[model samples]
Target: MSKTGKSKHRFPEFTDADAWEQRRLGEVAEFAKGRGYSKKDICSEGTPIILYGRLYTNYETVINDVDTYTELQENSVLSSGDEVIVPSSGESAEDISRAAFVQNSGVILGGDLNIIKPNETIQSTFLAITLSNGSQQKELSKRAQGKSVVHLHNSDLKVVNLSFPTLPEQERIGAFFQTLDATIASHQRKHSQRRV
Candidate 1:
């Protein structure tokens, strides 16, 4: 479990693949903070919006659709469908470490969210998964400041090291997890219906 490029486990197909390369999260992505708007600005109808709290409460690794709406504010940040978002502040350090990929573009990104837009070298879903689990999550928790109200800034995220394989491999890995999440969601729906 020493910090290394090679993971203890990987997909069987990637067995012959090269060891993953380590890069700073900022090196492979551009960071931006979601602008304008807050819970008070939310509306019953308008532009779809994602507030920071939803990252931990309602979203998993990927957010393809949003349920919340808000009035479009000037200079508001919008998702490009390839951004990974993390809460800027949370009740605890562990809560602030959660990350989710925005898979639909044009959704308004509300305040208190740190958005990471990955370049061609990485997949958004894979990057979110990496940040939400393993070494990166622990690093983020350690970097988060404040006791009563934990905060994680983009500066703190920029320095964390992330290991990534080739783009094709990343896509395969992300797709696998995406499928798994879908299956789990479907089963949960079925279970909910059974209880009704």
Candidate 2:
């Protein structure tokens, strides 16, 4: 039995000892803080910019035609496999430390985010999924600190622990989820076409 109320699909790689490995997040990745860009810099074209607070509801990024920037302004370039995290956010304690992954190229993170590039051993999707999970979010919540506005510093993120399976297993897990996501997107497109 599983928590989802379905029969447990045993994953051979997920043993008790493998789950107990203590690995620091910094050891597995590099965290880069996003540079600040003024509101005036935004344009209707150029590059995609990801704002931190906007990721709360949407797991996948929503592109706005009106939102963009110049190549010169985009100091930090995000590739498909990189993970973006919201290190600082509004006064609400809940939104702080929320994270998302960059699924496409030509994307730049907004001021409040800290972009993380996972090493070759760890999959970006795995880290993104783990951060989004409730259990990890709770752990992050405890680490977040501030008076008026909550913030997750680099040190806080560096110490966060993550468990990983073999690289092959990670790739398999990511691929399975990618297929499911593509199917969902296809269904949504078809549904939208019918509505029109």
TM-score of each: 0.93, 0.71
Candidate 1 residue lDDT tens string, 74-135: 89898878999999999999999989999999999988999899999889989988898899
Q: Superposing all C-alpha atoms, what RMSD in Å does each candidate have to the true structure? A: 2.3, 5.7
TM-score for candidate 2:
0.71
Pairs in steric clash, model 2 = none
Residue 58 lDDT, candidate 2, scale 0-100:
44
Pairs in steric clash, model 1: none
List, residue by residue over 35-74, the lDDT tens digit for candidate 2: 7764566677677766665576445422222145545463
